[model samples]
Target chain A: DVKVTQSSRYLVKRTGEKVFLECVQDMDHENMFWYRQDPGLGLRLIYFSYDVKMKEKGDIPEGYSVSREKKERFSLILESASTNQTSMYLCASTLETGDNQPQHFGDGTRLSIL
Target chain B: SQKIEQNSEALNIQEGKTATLTCNYTNYSPAYLQWYRQDPGRGPVFLLLIRENEKEKRKERLKVTFDTTLKQSLFHITASQPADSATYLCALAPADAGNMLTFGGGTRLMVKP
Candidate 1:
């Protein structure tokens, strides 16, 4: 079984503070993604890393960035947290295409910005 | 712009019945479509995947159908139990190398026993 783990299951931060969400996968998948899920809006991709040190912006990337310094770890960074940024964040990983791989997700982190 | 839409209304059904969920997309042709199950407070778990050329795919109690011409996919859970209740999301992968997905707002399923 594949295991994707997020650093925090719950987090609270004040407005203007910088926040970090960490994710690690044991499967050594080449592709990792960060997504924020909001009520009614659904899951929107924030950023994704196809390989170490390579990142791409997804649909909703404003005010957020990502880091992939190693193959097993991916991190999501919020430059300045705001109340609107409060939502559940999910991390997922999958092998590159041509392998017919499906993404494995972490439990998710519920973030609260006050 | 490519977009995926799933019925946002919760689907309520009696136990031992089959529950069907719908997903529709527009603008882009996907190489494959995927269905996922998400329980409250947990990330989604992959359930099934149907390729464009394939008409349908099945895994135990779960079945998925893809209609490329209609730009729609249907997910079916047969003999559903209360444990089958969850939000079911449909995702699509573009026909390119990256395989980035576009997801729809999920439909919540409630199985009454």
Candidate 2:
């Protein structure tokens, strides 16, 4: 079974603090994604990486950045955390070459900015 | 803008009954659609995927149907148990998304014993 592991399951940070959320996939998937899930807004994509060293901004990329230093690891960085940044963050990965392949998701990180 | 809409209200069903969920999309033509199950405080797990050419797909006790003309997908769980209670999300892979999926708000299913 493919597993996607997230660094933290729960985190609390103060406002103006820097926050880092890490995701690693054991499936060697080339495509990785970060999303923030909220009550009514659903899961909004924050960023995605097609491969190592490549990143793309999603719809809600403001105040968020991503780093994919290696193929299996993708990290989401919040340069400065704010109260509104509190959300359930999810990391997902999918194989690069496939026909309608589904994404595998990590357990998620529930980050609360106080 | 691409949009996917799942039932915002929670669906309450008795055990041993089939639960059906709906997903509708607008302003986007997706190459395929997917369904996922998520428990509270957890990320969603991929359940099933249906392509544009396929009308219906099934696995175990779960079935998914996609209609391109209406831009809708339906997910059904047969003989649902208490363990099946959770939030079900529908996602779409837009042609321009580069393998990334856009998800819906999700419908929460509560199976009562």
Candidate 3:
């Protein structure tokens, strides 16, 4: 079975704090993604990496950045966390960069910015 | 602009019945559509995928139908049980090489016992 692990299941941070959310996948997938989910708004993509050191901006990438220094690790960085940034963060990966391939996701990190 | 709309925020159905969820998209064409199940406080789990070339796909009690002309996809769960209660999300992909997806808000299904 494919396992995508998020470093923190729950995190609390103050406004203007730099936040880093870590994720690792055991499957060694070529595609990795970061998404933030909120009520009524749905899951909005933040950033994605197809290869190490390569990143693409998703629909909502204004206050976020990503790093893929290694094949198994991907990190989402919030430059300065704000109250509005409080939401559920999810990480996902796929075996390949194909269209119909299902993505495996981590449990998620519930971030609360005070 | 590209957009995806789910049928509703929530749907309620009695156990042992069929639950139907709808996902509609506009201003874009997708090579395939996917359905995912997510429990409260958990990440979404892959359920089924249906391509444009295929009208329907099934996995046990779950079935998905895609209509490119209509730009719509329908997900159905047969003989649903209490355990089937969860939020279902639908996503659209342009082509195989591009895995970028536009996801709908999702429909939360609550199966009553």
Candidate 4:
């Protein structure tokens, strides 16, 4: 089975503080993504990396950034946490082969900015 | 702007009955569409994917149909059980996009025993 492990299940941070969310996938997929899911708004893509050290902005990338230092790990960073940034963050990875490949997701990190 | 929409916010059905969900999109040409199941507080899990050229696809009890002209996809679960109750999400991948997906708000299914 494909395993996508997230560093934390729940996290709390004060406003202006920096927050980091980590994700590691054992499937050796080449593509990784970060998304924030909220009530009624669904999952909005924050950022995605197609390969190591290469990242691209998604629909809502203004307040978030991502790092893919190695093929197996990806990290999401909040430059400065804010109340509006509190949401359930999800990390997913998929093979770069074709669009037909399904993305495997981590359990998710519920981050709260107070 | 391109948009994806699910037909309803919630659906209630009895066990053993078939559950059907609808997904629609506009202003974008998607090469393929996918369905996912998400329980509360958990990330969505991939369920099925149907390409634009494929009229229908199935996996065990789950079935999906895609219509490029109407830009709509229908997901059906046969003999749905209580365990099948969860929020179902539909995502679209446009041909122009490399691998990014656009997801709908999702419809929550409640199957009563």
Per DockQ, the best of the predicted structures is 2
Using lDDT, give the best candidate's number.
2
Which residue pairs in candidate 1 collide? none
User: DockQ numbers for every candidate?
Assistant: 0.67, 0.75, 0.73, 0.71
DockQ of 4: 0.71
Clashing pairs in 2: none
Give lDDT tens digits, candidate 1, residues A6-107: 999999999999999999999879999999999888889999999999999998999998999999999999999999999999999998867445789999
Q: By how many angstroms RMSD does model 2 differ from the true structure?
A: 1.1
Stretches of candidate 3 above 4 Å error?
Answer: A97-99
State how far residue B68 of model 2 sits from its true place (Å).
1.3
Model 4 spans > 4 angstroms off:
none
Tell me the lDDT of model 4 at A48. 93
| Minimal lDDT window, size 10, model 3 chain B | B94-103
TM-score of each: 0.97, 0.97, 0.97, 0.97
DockQ, model 3, C-alpha based: 0.73
**In model 2, which regions exceed 4 Å deviation?**
none
Candidate 3: TM-score of chain A is 0.97
> What is candidate 4's lDDT per residue for B1-113, written digit by digit as tens?
99899965689999999999999999989998999999998889999988888999999999999989888999999999999999999999977676789899999999999
Q: Which is better, 2 or 4, measured by DockQ?
A: 2
